[model samples]
Target: MTSTLILGGRRSGKSARAQALASTFAEVTLIATATASDGEMAERITRHQADRPAHWHTVESPLYLASALQQADAAGCCLLVDCLTLWQTNLLLAEDETLLARETDALLAILPRLQAEVILVSNEVGWSIVPESALARRFADEVGRLHQRLAAACQRVELVVAGLPLTMKNETGTR
Candidate 1:
């Protein structure tokens, strides 16, 4: 099994790229880590749902991502995680101090050992100035740390900018 991490900023086409790659596999299960707490977010989720193929299965696990991954992963199947940023946000907003760390650790431990091809999408949020709010700062710090750990665990790491993918790391040194 191969694992890939796709990192990009807002509107950088990270989701499209991950979906396109997953289309190559025989079967795909999208592990959506988003919750529509508001109308705008609900619209976004709907749009994403419309963009996917009818045959592709979707699993929504806003706070229980590791469990979803564990259940969906299988040989010859591909698991596409839309965005880790949203998952992190969900964990942070939960107000539970230990949830984020525990889930992050569980994900890191599970990724490298999965039997299916994994495509994880995350936002690159640390390029701009530091945020004034404590919550914003914590979010950036946590996402950065998560990205680093995921990159190390993934076989391929790609950075997307303006809808273009730039390969940062590849275990086989090709593709």
Candidate 2:
């Protein structure tokens, strides 16, 4: 089992990079976290769906990522999570801080136990200017923290910029 974290800003091609990596495996599963609450988000989801290969299995998991990962068959499989930012958004909307902490802990704990190659996509929002609203600031802070923790747990960490991936950490025997 191996875990990798791909971090970049919005439209930084991180998701595309994850897809390319996932394609190398025999079986691929996409854990899409985005929810279509508005027209713009719906269009974005449609575009993402169109971009994915027909053969890859897609699972809509806006919440309960730990359960989803636990249920997935990890052996010889590649699991790609599109972006964690939206997942964080969903958690924040719940207004239960305990749920956020619990979910994040569960996800981090399960990564090491999985047999599949896992690729986690997340937005690097901390590099930008501080957010104006309190909620936005909290979200940015939490996402940044989540990225840090996940990156440490992952075998490889890549930072994508302008469609280019700059490897931060790549363990031995990982192609």
Candidate 3:
């Protein structure tokens, strides 16, 4: 699998970039990690769903991301994981604190085995000032660490800002 990790702040065009890359494949399976827990979230989810092509398969996996990838992965297909931060939140809220590390470890371990082209979108939470709340701070720290680990595993790493993508790492070397 040709793995690419897209990191950016909110509204940085990470999803759009991932979608464009995935569209180049013959088949696409989108592993959506977001859930509509409230009205605004529902609206956002609806908008995203509408934006996607009807032919692309969507899998709602607020948790159990590794299993979702295992099931959706296929040769000659692209598996686009839209936002890993939400997945981390899901794991942090749904299970014991240890679950986050366990699930993240599983995801990293499974990446090498997946047969599909993998494009993962993640928020760059560490770029801003430290969050006020303890939980928020912890989330930011975990997400930052996760991005570092993912970048190491992925063949391509990009930082999207102002709707532009800056290649940080490629097959040749780390940019």
Q: What local lDDT does model 1 show for residue 170?
A: 96
Checking candidate 1 for backbone clashes, the offending pairs are none
List model 2 lDDT by residue over 52-124, tens digit each.
8999998889878977887884699998998899999998898677888999999998998888889999999
The TM-score between candidate 1 and the true structure equals: 0.97
The total number of steric clashes, by the backbone 3 Å criterion, in model 3 comes to: 0
Candidate 2 residue runs with Cα over 4 Å from true position: none
The whole-model C-alpha lDDT of candidate 3 against the native structure comes to: 0.92
- The runs of at least 3 residues in candidate 3 whose Cα sits more than 4 Å from the true structure, single-residue gaps closed, are 172-175
Candidate 3 per-residue C-alpha lDDT over 1-175 given as tens digits, one digit per residue, 9 for 90 to 100: 6899999999999999899888899899999999999999999899889888899999999888899999998999999999899999998787487889989999999999999999999999997898999999989999989999999999999999999999998983434
In each prediction, how many residue pairs overlap at the backbone (N, C-alpha, C within less than 3 A)? Answer: 0, 0, 0
Ranking by TM-score: 1, 2, 3
Q: lDDT for every model?
A: 0.94, 0.90, 0.92
| Per-residue lDDT of model 1, residues 1-175, tens digit only | 8999999999999999998999998799999999889999999999999998989999999888888999998999999998899999999988788999999999998887789999999999999999999999999999999999999989999999999999999995668
